[model samples]
Target chain A: MSDLADLYRDVVLDHARTPHGFGLRDGAAAESHQLNPTCGDEVTVRLHLGPEGAIEGISWEGHGCAISQSSASILADLAPGDSPEQLRSRIAGFRAMMRSRGEVEGDEALLGDAVVFQSASRYVARVKCAMLAWVAVEDALLKLG
Target chain B: MSSIAPTIAAATALEESEVYRLREDFPILREQMGGHPLVYLDSAATAQRPVQVLDAEREFLTHLNAAVHRGAHTLAAEATEVFEQARETVAGFIGARPDEVVWTSNATEALNLVAYALSNASAGRGGPEADRFRLGPGDEIVATEMEHHANLIPWQELAARTGATLRIIHLDDEGALRLGEAAEVIGERTRLVAFAHVSNVLGTVNPVEHLVSLAHAAGALVVLDACQSAPHRPLEVKALGVDFAAFSGHKMLGPNGIGVLYGRAELLNALPPFLTGGSMITTVTLERAEFLPAPQRFEAGTQKVSQAIALAEAVRYLQRVGLERIEARESQLAVRLHSGVASLPGIRVLGPGLGVERAGLVSVVVDGVHAHDVGQYLDDAGIAVRVGHHCAQPLHRRYGVTATTRASTYLYTTEAEVDAFLERLAGVRGFFGAAS
Candidate 1:
């Protein structure tokens, strides 16, 4: 029960109930449709880039498990106003943490509330669910540069 | 690793007491997961292979390892004898002649062989008799909305290539195909009717006899995806009256990389070959070649030699246990599983409702919890089940849910395991705090 609680923290449940930037946005610079074929979880991410090569805004919409949906909601909060390079570093850090298999602690200062997903790394099958939204963010970010 | 665990006693000595004994034959079932006895409820995905199958493959490889057919050595002759004997055994199991069975990589390839052959016939590839298999713009290929992607996609591609129309028989709220609309869906222009004998997700045993009759009356051929049925009960292709049927070896306590395609003798000889290569050919030239007949024509490259031998051993194992008894045990387990799960709060069993008989499986969708969460919850408690669209996206769409958690039974599955599955499942909604 403690492990389940750690994986499904209150913050994740709250984000799942009311997500940020969940609808489509017009005039976005790039868009991507990502699907986790195993569970039929899908997400469409749209990003708006400013003239300085910075992320001006981001939006998304999808349906899946709380892990995937909450991850997308968290990404909506974390991905905006950051340069593509910054987003790449965060994605790389998140990937490393997930691959650690509970060996490495998630850096709270860098990942913020997203660090709550560290417990999800123990489940090999659910790791993809946590990464689905970040993958879309990566693709959308690449289109900006 | 330091201590050996004591063996648990067999659960019951009922009419199907052999099922309890059968559990000891599968070594993996004895292992523990997460400090609890492993409860395997996902046999529909792929069943665990018994020791007889494993030993059969090993023994063959250790003593007689040679390519079958077209060899002069003694080992080759011995291997060929064993291979041909396996074909004969498989034929007897399905009530077909050895000449009527064609071996392939898996059920997916078996189905694609038939679809591609029809496509070839449409392109004027086969000889005169193949005209019975060709199709064009006005022709329609009818399948049900509940077909697995393997059965549905090939026909879709065939239609795309041959300018044919693809129609489907829709499912009702219970996930059963609406056979009431069979006549309207399958008209004179319908060239082929393809469907599953038993749905992998819904567990609904389709009315194959009735559907075959309708297709025959319309002058259309019938193809049955027996992937889910062949392993669960006694099957005779002649009695079913279908032109073709397909099943995978891995789903029936056999090794992987082997499958069987059963076609009526005359129909097989008439259809064009889907693959062409060494063993399937009679005489070869730079220009054109003469092809072998029926089963040989479809088997292109080197076959899964040891896997086929292991599959034959699996057939023998099933025979020894008696499929009728196996079927009865599974039916009782499925009824208990369905009723127990359905009785839980906020649980919706997909497919058939209460008092309705289905195959030995049950799929469920919780009210507010996703299937993935339910699966993880179950997995954490030492129970393994299948959670996904289960390769039937269109069928999932029809049911208005993207995914489901399915628990399936087999000959080795026990009543206590079903109870554990239900007990673990009963707490999922409460675990997720889903309103009941």
Candidate 2:
């Protein structure tokens, strides 16, 4: 059980169990369903942005493994309150981290809850699981915009 | 069967053992993955290559390799004979006559050929069955949600081209398609019924005979996605009586780049050639050219000479073990996998849960843990299982889940592997502290 912690870390599971802002908003600007067809992981992310293009709130309700759900949980907090431009930059940084083969060099703290999965770089398969919610949110935001 | 240690339970496990020993013929299984003995639970992706099959292809390329259906030279004659022989072996494996097996690049190409040929027929290029196979606005193509993208996409593209509507027989809560509703959906307007012989994602085996009969009653043709079923189970395609059947060789311990497209002679003769080029001609003139008869008309240019030979050898390996026994072994593996996961506290086994209904594969979702983490956990322990949608998106949407973790087995898998897999999965929730 060598730090089974790295693979299933407490921070990751906490967010998965108690995902922040994890519910569908009543009036959403746009909703998008993205599926990673390889292992059957699916997530339907809904975006509710303020009139000024700030992410008012974002939520997801779908089925996936803990990494994905927890990743979604972490994403919920970061999504709302940011201006569209800042949010877009975060998406770029996150995408770069995800697609990076190894060594996501950045302020790990800024990613907040997503930092728990920093060790995910070692496992390629789980990276998609971690990225599914993030990708869905980005895709939903873009589609909503 | 002769040298291998017999299974613990014969009548129950023997049938699967037949397939298991058959798996021994595949050489790659002897290798390791992730520094651990590869308990490959991912045969549904692409099976490992057997030694004999590998050698056969090697031997062909070294000595007898040449272009087929061409040349007056000695090597060409030898190459042509060997290539045709592989076709005969493929035909025999599917229980079809040699003339009926049309070799394509792979199953996808085979299906595209069928759809395009039908489209041509609707456009008045077909010989006899032209009107019979034609699709229009009034016509319908019915399939189940369990179709792999290979089967579903071609029909979808075909439906878009012709004015035909694509209909479906939805699945029940267990991820099994309601076959009875097939009778209802496959009616007069149903021009063709396309479905997977086995659900690639769910591991649910469809009733080919009943579906075929239903389609025939409505005067519609049936095409089978034998990609999953043909490799793992025993198939008598002729008896299955589909109008056209498509399956790739790569999934069956054979080489890539070759696939078997089994169609009835009468229907095949009526269908036009999908690919146009050298080697598929009867007479050529400056103005126009006449195409040769199928399986050659569909196989234009140079065929996968060595791969076809290797695939033929793969068929021989399976035959030696026997399809009946292979199907049985996989069924037992499926049952064990299903029960093991079903018993887990937060686990919900997808598709046809525990039964002979599922063909040696199980997809499940845990309450608290994510499938990817579970997959990562398993991979650490030297277990390899496919996680995510398994390529049937509609099936996932229907199940009301974005994805499910799938552990699929073949004859090569052992009970120890299944037990170890289940054990690791059981620990996932607790390790994450997400256990309720």
Candidate 3:
């Protein structure tokens, strides 16, 4: 269906193939490992903070479906240069979009490439896949706090 | 090595027309998925219920609904008689005495019952009667790497509680159990051997008789996880010489919330009850309560009465169709399933290789495409399959993968359905741009 195309857009596929900040890095402020027990997908996200506690870098490594891998890559791409508060707001926005169940169009300004997951939100099972990395990053931020 | 006589001689595969006719019995087959006819190939997860099973449950609830074994009224008498008859039917289906069959919520609970009962016995709950079931330091429990978590975790807990070591019978690269390792592992100190008759993920049927002989020689009890085999093949627990077995009803075209646990009558009567309350005891005082015999001792609280009746009807349906014929038909599908997927480039079929006589299911790993993506593509095409660790995380780890796409078949599964699944699966890699 067209919705399937929407879920796996060209940008998402590109990110999944060659994800940004794909490897776990050293000298991080905090790191968190999250597993999606339903499908055995997992991710370990490392967060790097600037001197003023702004988000400097986010790196992650994991194995999972395209949705999860691409979502992680997109999160890593958008998380830089934002404060922990800004990143938390982004996380909340992405979570709200996922929970919308196709009813709400995501804010492209806030979610950026992550808005492509709006189609994935229609699939109840795949919502977790899109959120796996975001949850890991959230956990990492909590650890930093 | 089975002592029970075969129900039928070797038979030819069911005709395509006959399979089509049988498919009519499942109303869900008529439903459409993603604007296409539903091609159900996930029977290993849970088989679609036939009309007979649905009617059996509704019929019982409409006419014979009553609390069984407690009331003395006419309705209660009728309900109890029907309930016991259902037990007899299930018992006969598995080649066990009626008294040896215990009703559980599902196979998980059934396995837990035995595990917790043994733990209770080890804690001196059943006194000297359950001495044979007790395990302490120096005792061992053996399980295989390919077991579903339901069968594996209970034994892990059992060993953790009793201080008995938990050993594993590793699998070969082909996904079959290594009987040599099993022989070495199941030695004198082994108190119990727990394994699945067929791997839920790999679909490789384990060597029941060989493992049974090994456990028997070690003077250890055998607990067979028959969840995968009982629905596809003729399972004679007594003939297999297993001391205990567990299987779910939903996987066999029966209703959910009902499962059967088969144990030797003497062994069941001796073990302490896991869930103690009303309907399972002989008498009770403020401080202590005496439990009843075998099946009743294990059945506590309100039972899944209607579900059990429906499961019996499901068993009767299988019997009437003849398990040998179903088995024969499924074997042909298994070959087709294995070869069809194996022939595809970059597709690695798990479990037995081509011509290796696996059960009627095939799980495969598409080289570059993740199983979830493959599963989603197939789902869009209205082809249902199971994709994940399939509750055997260790087996997946052994294979060096996190998940796999599994297509399983049953009596109602047609050749066209299997082909449809494969055709959709063949396109998954190309769609995902992972075609190598």
- Write down the C-alpha DockQ for each prediction: 0.76, 0.52, 0.85
Please tell me what DockQ candidate 2 reaches: 0.52
Docking class of 1: medium
Clash count for each candidate, listed in order shown: 0, 18, 0
Total colliding residue pairs, candidate 3: 0
In order, candidate lDDTs are 0.87, 0.79, 0.91
Candidate 3 residue spans exceeding 4 A from truth: B1-10
Question: Across residues B1-436, which tens digit of lDDT does each residue of candidate 1 receive?
Answer: 1011222212221244666678889999987987878899999999998999999999999998899977999999999889888888888888889999899899999999999999999999888989878899999999999999999999999999999999999999987889888779988999899999999999898988999999999999999999999888777889999999999999999988999999999988888899998898889989998889988999888988888899999988877766666666777888889999978989999998877768889999988888998998888778999999999999999988999999999999988889999999999888777865
lDDT of 2 by residue, A14-109 (tens): 777777777676788778887766666678888887888788988778666777788888888887788767776776777677667457753465
Cα displacement (Å) at residue A140, model 2: 7.8
In terms of lDDT, model 2 sits at: 0.79
C-alpha TM-scores of all predictions: 0.95, 0.88, 0.98
Kindly list the per-residue Cα lDDT of model 3 for residues B30-122, writing each as its tens digit. 999979899999999999999999999999999999999999999999999999999999999988999999999999999999999999999
Best by lDDT: 3
lDDT of 1 by residue, A1-145 (tens): 5677888888987787687889998989999889999999999999878889787777899989889989889878887778888877888888888888877777776677788888999989889999998899888877766
* Model 2 CA lDDT for position B345: 90
Q: If ranked by TM-score, best first, what sequence of candidates would result?
A: 3, 1, 2
Error of 1 at B83 (Å): 0.6
